[model samples]
Target: MRTVGHLLSRPVAIGTALVLVMLIAGFVGWRLTGGGEYVAPTPSAAPTVRADTVAGRDSLEELVAGVRDGAKPEGKGAAAVATRNADAIGIEGLSARYVAESGNVDEDGSWTADVDMSWRAPGDPTLSEELKVGFDGDGEITGFSADEGTRMPLWLSGPVEVRRTGSTLVVVQASAEQADRYAELAASAVKQVRTVIGWDRPRLVLEVPASGLDSALGAQPSTYSSVAAVTATVDGSSTAGSPLHVWVNQDVIGDLDSPGAQVVITHEAVHAATAAPTNPHRPMWLVEGYADYVALRDTTLPLSKTAGQILAQVREDGPPKHLPGKAEFNTRSEHFGAEYEAAWLACVVLAEAGGQEALVDLYEQTGRGVPLERALRASFGFGVDELTARWRTHLSDSAR
Candidate 1:
């Protein structure tokens, strides 16, 4: 299969968002630690001896010089270099193209070099990797990595079209015409998220791949087949500093102007904006709910349209006994839409009771490993039970 080239080194959390009565599943929020073990690449064959090298000089420097001259080392040396390079770059399953940009050996017999390189996986030729590399005195590779701000695979390389919208960089992986169209929608979504959340200088990287939504998301859930988009962390580490990737599933979001598409973009943008490695102990409902809340905030869409699923459930079964829990947000759950609606309304209650600032403070606090109930009490002067009661009432009134 010809999949689009993009990098995804993180596990994803799946949720859904309802917009104008349209259920778009696959909205993810916050990075979560300890997911999907990384599979390391098999060791390469040993390096070959180069009879052309002069005696008494560092082999590593010779290797570096060879790379500068557009040569790749072979055998054991090649294997070592490849392994080190992969570790430094934080990716595996790659074949590297190394170029020594600049370097010098120190008096201590140690050498350092600034090398530029690209990594390409056999499975995806379109996406190649690029980063600067640093080598130690012993010729061991050191500090090889790409910037955490925006990491793109080779397919997303030049000719892919990059547009800067505020602090966000929108990379469109499609024809120039289609890319331009996606860029406009993404820019609008970024602006709306910044304005509503009071995030003045938020930085984001949004990608609209021509294909390979599953590759970008690492794994595609069957339930997310209709999802418009999703946001995922680069490395699954809260502190990795890798960029948050907003992946738009073109199949579902082909029409950027549709109400559902706009809402999906904004909702996923909120996840990107507020992204942090989440405290597993914290309630996922709040994390996801807050994203939905920000996405739906201030929209003129009727409550009946936005919260129709929850309202319908309420009409049949009455208000939920409690706010949506983590399990309720499961993609396979029959109540996926209802769960998201309940979570969104829960945040709505929080916003109404204490204002948007309080909701944000609560979100940030909980994200920083603070207990959810404690964060709630601190920000809203109420406990979870009390807030749950209020949210239930809010649901009843909103449904009516």
Candidate 2:
């Protein structure tokens, strides 16, 4: 299935977003065959590896028992029951309120159990993670971890403080008190989104993990190496109707003050509200530029600071001859932040030429299966080339 990933990774306190996360499609499947009734011939004169315990299908239900509501996993392996009422898992605050969709166990019956676990804060939509739950015979779960190289979500990784506000929620690995602060930011973000297109989503979930880079809730840590926050499906699948969550990289967001943090979240919130141009064919400049438009709209940030990166490039090399392409949005590019600034300016030029309504009309029409040229012509009396020309002129003026 084709899926979309939106990335907004930044430096300390600015917006350098590469909102399109494209999942690569080439992973080879592998299988290891050994351990059978017959012995191997190659190691006849040497030691042959074997399973001490025969592999078998098992259920975790018999292992993990009596999980009450709103509780945390208490005891585990051997040390959990021996110490000062410490959490069996090294981390604390694991919510036991999760509903185990299935208690699946692998053949070896080692520490890990592959389970479809789900949890939701009160009054919010559910988020699901396929976690490898560590378990012991004494009805205790030790820890939850994902497959190798995959990022761990806050809910399953460890203790999470859940704060629900209106139809939105903030689940953080940070302190419970911090969850409240994130909740406020989430509310403001929702309001920003509402101001733009109108918020119709049932719930808006924001995850602000303390270990920002360590827990991005996506594939490949390098993919989100610089992402400050991302607004994408809960499981990272671009499947239609998947749950959307605004995930923040605290390490990047922490550099920003209160207002800047609000702006970052609002930028992500715009993606959540629109489901981010849902159609993959839509140009990213329109998708991300619109988001930046709404985020920077109410800010007092001057063009020099907001578009500082792009402005510097313009002064040195003149305004970009064309709009930022999908390739220019690379997080590792030399002018990464500048690309976002340029795209935002492109949208600003659109808003200037046509009213905000016309700008929005073009986006909505494109999302609804209309071609970009037709939508632009119908809404702004121009095509991509014309828009690019105007955007270049606006870029020059803004730089000055």
The estimated TM-scores of all candidates read 0.59, 0.72
Cα lDDT tens digits, model 1, 184-261, are 667778878877676666766666766545554445435455566767665434543445667777776885566666
Q: Report the CA-based lDDT of candidate 1 relative to the real structure.
A: 0.61
Per-candidate total of colliding backbone pairs: 10, 4
Summarize candidate 2's per-residue lDDT along 23-75 as a digit string, tens digits: 12111111234334555566447443332221211223322221222224355
Compute the lDDT for candidate 2.
Answer: 0.66
Q: What is the C-alpha lDDT of each candidate?
A: 0.61, 0.66
The 10-residue segment with the lowest total lDDT in model 1: 1-10
**TM-score winner:** 2
- What CA RMSD would you report for each candidate? 26.9, 22.8
